[model samples]
Target chain A: MIRIGIYGLGKISRRVIQGVLSSNNACLYAVCSSSIEKANIFKKEYQAEKAYDNYERMLEDRNLDLVYICTPNYLHTKHIQIALSYRKHVVCEKPMCVSTKELNDCFDYAKRQNCFLMEAHKTVFTPLNQKLFEMISNEEFGEIKSIDAQYATRLTEQISDWHFSRPGSGCMFDIGVYPICYANRMAKSSIFRVSRFQDEALIEYENGCVAHIATSWDVDMENTAHIYGTKGSVSCKNFWKNTEAAVNGSKITVVQESDFTGEIEHACTCIENGMIESPVMSRKASLEILKVIGV
Target chain B: MIRIGIYGLGKISRRVIQGVLSSNNACLYAVCSSSIEKANIFKKEYQAEKAYDNYERMLEDRNLDLVYICTPNYLHTKHIQIALSYRKHVVCEKPMCVSTKELNDCFDYAKRQNCFLMEAHKTVFTPLNQKLFEMISNEEFGEIKSIDAQYATRLTEQISDWHFSRPGSGCMFDIGVYPICYANRMAKSSIFRVSRFQDEALIEYENGCVAHIATSWDVDMENTAHIYGTKGSVSCKNFWKNTEAAVNGSKITVVQESDFTGEIEHACTCIENGMIESPVMSRKASLEILKVIGV
Candidate 1:
């Protein structure tokens, strides 16, 4: 099994620990946080093998085969570089890097180090979406004609300051990436034209498909993703972490222990195969998300 | 009572006949078509008093107080002008005019002739939508913040050549006006910015409301309209003619004779009140729809 070290003990790391614990090909070996107390707390709760306040200290453990970076958006590049420099495979959270340049640099460094790397877009790697993609590839719904996905939430509680003023901030980078990644993955085509207005975008694909992706923090939305095609359509509510979807009105479901497990398992599988990067969430795929963000 | 004459015995005119016949404040007095046989057939079937093959012949009748113009889109300006010339109040079908210039010209002619004129936007005039608009105006769902409306259908059957090659021909002008008018009416604020991509548009309203309206002949969409506010949400399926809506989880419904009756009755009410245009669908309101079309 891949020995996974989590590089952040934020709220998302709790879920990552659950994912690694549930994953067949991975184990939660260690955790690092700015607060050693928090790191030790997570280690005790999730039964991790080690905890460290320093990222370098965690990376120095040669047994750590993979690192999962869940730091804030602006710090992703730095975390990824340190993990990769240790010759460890890495899975970084969404908005992996703010722009394409940062993305290219991280992947290029990973290439030089010969370590597996990928952006963790759990929306596409979820078993439910994986099945839908396979079905769409088989033309079950005919050629995709259009897609509409929206993710909006009211900011009810306090959030980190970086979410507002950092380089990779705002609702688009925070939550918009969910709908953007979902649409781009299902489209199975390259982008043709994109028009961004506020937190919404209309993307026209080279294969004659159009997608409208929207996000906001002002109000709550349906949080639904709809895929339309010539033959029929598919829709799922709360699609970012959904375990089920309606395929032309028929329910297709998957039992998921943790939504993040599939991505962890996939990342571990890629590392085991001696792959330098995930074929599914490759550098090109990571760049496409930023391309829609116009970075 | 308002004695109504319908011009252009096309497919939509049948519904107009049903509306007028069922209306308590209006009578279907005359039917006009280029084909005298078709006009005579419609008049007899709908119990009209007269049938004429020529527009001038129908307008010659002194009792024809109102003319409902259902001509093809590109010809709406001409029909509205001639009807106003006869001192007849007019209600033209959607795509009232292709451009703001034509809309102003026709309304100005109506003003000079002391005749009432309004565009028949059935989506806004539908009884259910009127109630929703009133509820929104009253802030029953708090302040409106976002609206999303879409109408799309596949071209399964051959349509008229005008649908492909006329001035107001594309999907945006054809059925797109439904969602545009719906969003504009619900927003209840002036437009701030608009981004048009293919047949989709994202509009920001002055009061901080955002609307995404879309249409296509390439695919069939959900055909739903969602109005989200600060506190709650409202959604209607097949919203163009829906008689019911879900308000924050509860169903609100209205009984209707024909979907077109509300607009026809509103037009007749405006003429009876000695008003030059409908307060609900004023000259400025009609211009806003065309403005979003970017014509």
Candidate 2:
């Protein structure tokens, strides 16, 4: 089994813990939190084998084969570098790094340390997305022409939330990455130019496809993604967590349960095969997404 | 009773005939077609009073108070000019003119002739759209932030269709005008800048609100319109012919039967009241929509 240690006690970390617990080839080995009491409570509640208040001390555990960094966006680079220095495989959350320089540094360090590092954007690992990738590869929907993706939230009242006030917590990094990643996948080429007005963006790819991405904190939008092709089109509601897709107005089931387990399982499978990067979500793709976000 | 004359014997004119026939105070007085056989057949089928192969001859009918110009896009300016010279009220279809110069000239001539000239954009006159306009006027959803609208058709095999081969029949002027009109209504301001790639456009209004409009002949799209505001949002599916709207996830029936009658009725009411333009779809609004499309 791949022994996993998580480094946060936030809401997203809880979902990651659940995913690890549900995976057949992974086990929750340890958890680190700022508060010992909270760490102990989380370890007991989630059936983790060990709990530590200090992150550095937890990294000293030789038995832990992997570390899932669920810290804040600004702390991702620091936490990921520490995990890689410990010679442990790393799974960092989305917006892996705020800047392209930091992303490049992390990849270089991971390669030098001979440790695997993957950004945990679970949306792409969902069964629906996998099938979409398959369809695009096989040209089931013909050549892709354009993509429209949106992720907006109606959180105007949540003024005190870090998502609104934090330095690196704008919609571009938090939610805009989803559409950018999907657009990158569908365009299958580098984005040559981009024009943005507030939280809305129009991205032009080198392959003649354009992507319209909108993310907002002021309004509640239909969190959906649409892929338009020459022959037909596909659409899904809540595409980031979608389990079913509609192709040419006909519904089809893509997965049984749309959860985070598929991404976790993918990480474990890559580690088992002694690969440093997942074939589906590679390091180069992750870097490209960050470059687009940072732009 | 209001007497209506129609120009063009095309698919859209058939719908216009149906709308006029269904109205309580309107009668189909005359029709003009390039082909005399088609004009006579249309007049006979729709029970019109007269048919003329020459458009100029049809405009000479003193009994016809208004003319519905449903000819090809290239012929709109010419037909409207002729009708205005004859001192007849006009209801031209969407994309009232292809260029700003033509739009300005038509409006100026209509004003000089003391005749009403309204663009028959049925979407904005629907009951649902009226309520949305009222809500926006009252700031029920707070300040508008952005609007996303799309209308795409999958007609890859119909290469010979005018929508693909005609000079002014690209997606921008065809289906793209719908979203442009909707965005213009919601923005309530002039669009200062626009960036376009193929059929997709991003329009930035002077009031800091941006509109993302996508129209395509290459693929199928959701055909939906979403308006995002500071406090909440509104969405309508098949917005061009929508009868229902959702405000913050609560569905409301806005119209009993969605048809072209609302616009036709509005035109009749304006002409009855001796007004020179429709209050709902004014001459200025029509010109602005055409300007955006021309861009």
Candidate 3:
């Protein structure tokens, strides 16, 4: 099994722990937090082998085969470099880095260390979306002509202040990536033209597909992703991590324990094959996301 | 009662006939077509007061106070001029003219002749949308933040060749106007920024509202319109002429005989008040739709 250590103990770490627990090819080796008490509690609660107060301390464990970085958005490059210094494969969360230069630097460093690294875009690795991408490639709906996807919520509860003061903050970075990554993946073509207003964008692909993507935290939305093609269309609500979708109005579903498990499974499989980068969410894929954000 | 003459006895005129017949303030006084047989059949079928093969002959009726022009899109300016020369008010179909200059010329000429002229945008006059707009203005949903509207259909049958070759034709003019006009009427602010690709557009209103509107004849879609705000949201299927809608999940409906009658009623009211232009679908409103189309 590919032993994994999580480098953050924040809210999203719980889902990552669930994913690691459910992954057949991996095990939860360690979890680190600035607060040792939270780390120990998480380790005990999730049956992890180790817990460390400092990230460097966790990376010191020779048994830790991989590091899943869920640190604050700004700390990704530093945390990634530190993790790779110990020769650990790393899977960083989305918005992997705010700028193209920073993201390329991380991948180039990982290459020198001969360590596997990928951005964790759970939306693309979700079982439902994987199947949808394959279907589009197979032309089940014919050439994709249009795409519409959105993610929005009213934010009933207060969020971390980091969401406001951090670089690449606000809804565009926090929520807009859902629709952006989803559309970019499904369009399957390089962007020919793009225009943006607010957090919404109209992207025309080189192969003639047109996509409109939007996201907001100020109000609620349907949160559905729609793809229209020459022959038919597909749509799913909460597409960022959906396990069910409709293909031409027919329901298609897959059993899913933790929505985050697919990414973990894919990452573990890549490490098992001695791959230095993911074929799916590769360095190039991460850069493309940033390009659409105009980084 | 406003005495009405329909200049084109084509496919859409049937709906115009139904609207006029059901209207409380207008009557179908005349029907004209290039083929006298077709004109006579429509006149007999709708019980009109006059039938003429020639356009100018029909517009000469002394009692005809209004002319509803549903000719080919390219012929709008010439048809409107002929009817206005006979001293009759006119309601021309959408895409009243091809460019900003042509539209201005038509409106300016109508002003000189002291005749009322307006573009027929039945979407804004639909009972369901009027109520939705009222709720928005009343802050029933609180300050609107986003609007999304789309109309798309798979062309199961062949359409006219003009759809491919007419100036300012294609899906954007034939169908995109529905979503464009709907969003513009609901935004209630001048555009701060706009972007377009294919037939989809992202518009940022000066009041900080954002809208994404799209339409196509290439594929089938949900054909729904959604408007979101601080408090809640509203949505309706077939929003261009819908008689019912859902406001934050509560269904709201209104009585209706014909969808086209709403525009007719509004235009007749303006005429009765001795107004030479529609305060609703005014010269500025038609110009706004064209502007979004990048005229």
Candidate 4:
């Protein structure tokens, strides 16, 4: 089994811990949290081998073959670099870092350390989305002409949170990345231009396909993605965490829910095969998304 | 009863004829078509009083007090001018004309002729949308923040039609006007800037309420509009011809289907009251929408 160390015990990290425990090829080895009490409780509840209040201490654990970075937006690059220095494969969450330069640095450091690095964009790994990719490749819906994707939430009470703040937060980094990733993967063409305002963006691909993506904390919107092609179209409601899809008005059965398990399973398989990155969630794709987001 | 003459016996003209026939305050008086056979057939089928192959000859009928200009996009201004010259009230289709100059000219002529002129944008008159407007005015959803509206249709076989042509044709003029009108009336704030690409646009209002409107003939999309406010949101599926709406997730029942009847009824009421413009589908509203469309 690939022994896993989880950095951060935030809400998302808890899901990562559950995913690690559920995976057959991975085991929950350690957890790092700023609060020792929270770390101890999490370790005890999840049956993790060890809990560290300090991130550096957990990174030094030689038994941990991989580390899942689920820290805040700004701290991702630092944690990934530290984990790579210890020669551990890394799976970091979305908005992997705040900038393209930081992302390139992380990839370079991972290459030098000969360790695997992948952004934990779970949506792309889900069976539903995989089927979508396959359909696009096989021209099931003909050539894609346009895409409309959005994720909006009424976080009225959380306006003061980092998500709406100036630095390290905004709807673009928080939720807009989902559609940006969708556009990048599905467009299958190089993005030639982008026009954005506040948290909304319109991307134009080289092949003339255009994608409109929007995210907002001011109101609630249907968290959906609509992909339009020449012959037919595919729509996935609650696309980020979808368990089903519809193609040409026909429901597409999705066997598994989009959870962290898929990414964890894929991460373990890639690490075991001595691969440095995930085929589904590649560093190049992440870079392209960040470039569009200008971060 | 108000005698109505329809200029153009095209597909939409048939709907206008049906609307006029169904209204208690209106009667189908005359029809103008390039094909005399089609015009006579339509008049007989709809029980109209007269039919003319020449548009100017039909406009000369003294009994026809109102002229519904349902001609092609490029012919709207000329027809509206001719109807105004005959001192007849006019209800033209969406995109009243191809340019702001033409719109201003038509409005000027209507004022000088002492006649009413209204665009047949049926969505604004629907009971479902009226409730939404009332809710916004009452601050039921707090201050408005954003709006997303799209109308896309797949015309794969008709790619060579006028909808895909250059002058006075494109998705923006054909369908993007729906969202533009939605934003114009619902925003109640002046749009200060717009960034657009191909068939998509992002309009930013003075109060920071950004509206994203996209339409295309290249693909099929959810012909829906989503309005976002600070407290809650409202989404109307099939928004342009919406029969239902949901406010904060509870369905708002729509009483009347969004057909030409709503606008026709309103136009007839406005004309009977000696008004120069519709309260719902106002000339100012139409001007604002056309400005955003830039044609």
Candidate 5:
């Protein structure tokens, strides 16, 4: 089995543990929480061999082959770098750092370490989005005319915490990064410049395609991206959900092109088979994502 | 020939004259420019018998059946009211007026005079857009999820020329009105609430549809709008240009759906066929446009 140590026992970290436990080829080796109490709870719940409050002490065990980094926005780069220095393959969560410089440095260190690193970029790994990339890259929609992608989550009194704080979290960097990534992925070339405002970000790529992306923690949550091609347009609602694809002005909707869950499972199996160093979230892609997020 | 009077002999007025003269059903009857010198020159060029420097004197002549108002943003209400008082069919340029109150007054006057009053919204006259609308209204694209519309004409140099001035004109009220209208049309509802910022407009309607419209007189120009439905999405470039509709995940790029010139001709012909008021771009519609623009 491919043993793994998960760092940061937050909500996302819990989700990662669920995903790992559900996978057939992987097993949880250890878990590192900020407190010994939470770590002990996770270890007892998951039947892990050990639990450690200090992540560095856990990394010294050398039995774990991979480390999952699921800390806050500020701690991602540092945790991933520490994991990489231990020569362990790493899967860091989104917004891996707060700036391009830190992401670049982390990438250079990963290259020098000669170990695998991947950002848990689930959007690119989804089935519908993969087909979207293929169709767009093939010029199926012809030349791109424009793009509008946005992710807005409502932060009413019921669910407002740590997201609206200054110096760290907000909608633009936290949720806006997905739509920006979508625009960057479908554009013919890299984004040349970005025009950022309070809750919106307009990015102009070199290939004459422009993307308008906005995010808001102030309103209810919505995840969607739309691409306007010369010949037609394509739209997807809830970019992170397993929703069906709907074609505008045509009879096609909910294209069952590929099984996304199956693909991800297969990738995990490949890693276990030693057929690949890591899974679909390649190190190179993670670095590019970091650059766009400026994190 | 249909006798026509031209009001507000500005640059757009010149374009309308060119279009009208080139048409078979219309001929110039009188000219009214802000200055007597310009009106006299236009009258001599078009071989008109009358040239009035003042609108009150021009309205008293009683020979013209139609009047086209191409004045500044703030002057639309005053000019349209005067034209309606004289029982002349009216076509006023965009923004309609500086505020919703002005639009309501114009609409009320048009109703009282039993005259035709349109805001000269040409985007709705595009053929490709017409096709998309037919498909959507016919439930071809299922229920709409959202509308992402934008129209940005890079004219930072002209920002000081009253078009981008505070209150009366800027990116949101000037070019942004087109996309807002499109969203309002496709959504089939009036906007209930709007959050405005320096660079963005977030509009939500009572009918469960949302529009994120961004425009800038300070940035490079890109004109486009994408309508997203639960079943599919439709898009057009240059909002004024009719273009193809590509369905999501489909490879085919159809062309007939892209041509919108036919629709413009048809809408204009409908006016002479006693279709004095259109469902799209009606007086009520202009009021909604003004509401979003916040005058």
Candidate 6:
């Protein structure tokens, strides 16, 4: 089993824990939290082997094969460095660092430590996104035209407590990365510059293709990504799930296509066979992703 | 007296000639057309004293104050140069010249002529857009945030023959420029770069703000500009009307705030006052606008 110790007792951490336990090749070995109260509560609740109130103490356990750094924007670099120093493979969240410079440093350190590192950009790794990319490459959609992707959530009431804090806690880093990363992959180009309004940035590429990204921690949206091509168009109602396509003259309504089958077992097999060689969350792609997030 | 000659007997020329002749300070003194038959017809229709079958013959009419160029895209630079050769001022429409290099040539001749010249981006002088600018400047909506503006018209069935031709004509120049211009004014920055997908390009600034522009000449849209700010948001349902704003939490929507009552009239007055020192459409702005036209 690939034993894992998860850090950061947030909602995402909880979700990851559940997904890990549910996966056949993964097992949750321990949990760590900054808050002692939350750590003890989670240790009792999840019935894990141990709970450490401090990340350093949690890293002392030699039995853990890997560590998942699911912390906030600022602590990612520091946490990853410590986890790698302890000779553990690491997977961190998106917008891996504040700047490309910091990301470069992390990449250098990871090479020196000889530890596996991934940014956990799960959207690109999903079965739905793969199918969409495959169809696009096969010229199934004629020629690519434009893409509009938005992921907005009402975080004002529920998430303002930690989201608007100091040291880069904002919508762009948290949720904006979703659309930015998706648009970059769809267009297959690095965004050179970004035009920003209140919270929306229209990212532009060297080739003159533009991606309209709308992300708000204070609004409500279903996280949609719509692709408009020459012959037809395909849209993901939420993230990359349930994609629907239509051509220029079709009288189609704005309904989500219901037939996209999830390739859960296929992705698991890819992982087990070590066939997923192209890391969906590469350091170069993450650097480009962070440039928009830096805004 | 500002004596003006109009080229091209197209629909835009029809309205512009009428507007210019109706103005007391400007007179539509001459008409030019590639076809002598059309020139004679236009001369009789508009009651213009002079008719020129050739563009050079009209340029020889040295008494003309300005030449309003309404020819096809490829002919703009050629006509502007001919007009400027005889020291006549020029007013060309949007997408001033087919390409940025061509636009630069137009600027060079305008400088050589030492006369007034501009692209006719009249939407900026519209009452609605003017009020939108003032409201944002006064911080009436608190801090400015994001603006989403779209201009789309269905063209599949209605596209004119010339619209699909190779030399010029597309959505980016036709209706796309309006949103881009408005967004530029509202955001008050030059676009860093643009992304081109098929026939569309989305523009963004370095600040992380975005502008969504679509022009299909083949699709129908609401044709509106939505401006979102911190205190409240304002929107204009139609480009030709004034926008309305509400203080973030308030129920009252104020339409046509007191400051800008008659914007087009003010533009004319500015012209009369030599406050029109620069043409209504500055050469620099028009050149940048042409860059996104992707010609």
Tens digits of per-residue lDDT for model 6 on A1-295? Answer: 6677889988777767765656656667888998888888877787778888888788889888678777887888898889878877777766667777777887778778776666766666555676677777776665554567777765445664456785557888777878888887776667767665555656767655567778875545435576655555666666644334333434233332221112222233434554322245667778778776663
Best by TM-score: 3
* Per-model TM against the reference: 0.96, 0.89, 0.98, 0.90, 0.56, 0.68
DockQ of each: 0.54, 0.59, 0.84, 0.58, 0.06, 0.15
Error of 3 at B236 (Å): 0.3
Give the whole-model CA lDDT for all candidates, comma-separated: 0.90, 0.84, 0.89, 0.83, 0.68, 0.66
Per-residue lDDT over A1-295 for candidate 5, one digit per residue giving the tens place of the 0 to 100 score: 7778889888777767776776656778999988999999999998888899998998898798778787787778889889888888677777766676776787778778866566665666565777777888888877775677778764445433555563346766677667766776767566666555455555666776767676665443335566776655677777654445654445333443232333334445655565423434554455445444454
Question: Candidate 5 local accuracy as lDDT?
Answer: 0.68
Ranking according to lDDT, highest score first: 1, 3, 2, 4, 5, 6
lDDT per residue (tens digit) for residues B37-110 in model 3: 99999989999989989988877778889999999888898898888888889999888887899899989988
lDDT of 5 by residue, B191-278 (tens): 8777554445667778767776766554433355666666666656666554554545342233442232242344356467765566
Model 6 root-mean-square deviation: 6.8
- For B60-110, candidate 4 gives per-residue lDDT tens digits of 787889998887787788889988998999998877887778888998999
**TM for chain B in all models?**
0.98, 0.93, 0.98, 0.94, 0.83, 0.82
What does the interface RMSD come to for each candidate? 1.6, 1.2, 0.9, 1.3, 9.7, 5.1
Ranking by DockQ: 3, 2, 4, 1, 6, 5
**Model 6 chain B, poorest ten-residue lDDT window?**
B257-266
Give the per-residue lDDT digits (tens) of candidate 2, residues B1-295: 7899999888899988888887766789998899999999999999999999998798888999999999888778998999999999899986778787887888889999999998888878777887788899899889898899989887645543655565457878888888988888888788777777677888888898889999887788878899988887898888877778889889977643436877888899888999997776886787677666653
Sorted by TM-score (best first), the order is 3, 1, 4, 2, 6, 5
Docking class of 2: medium
After superposing candidate 2, which stretches have Cα over 4 Å from the reference? A156-161, A186-189, A230-232, A248-251, A254-258, A291-294, B24-26, B156-161, B228-233, B246-251, B254-258, B272-275, B291-294
> Residue B253 of candidate 2: its Cα lDDT?
76
Query: Which number leads on lDDT?
Result: 1
Worst ten in a row by lDDT for model 4 chain B: B158-167
Give fnat for candidate 1.
0.34
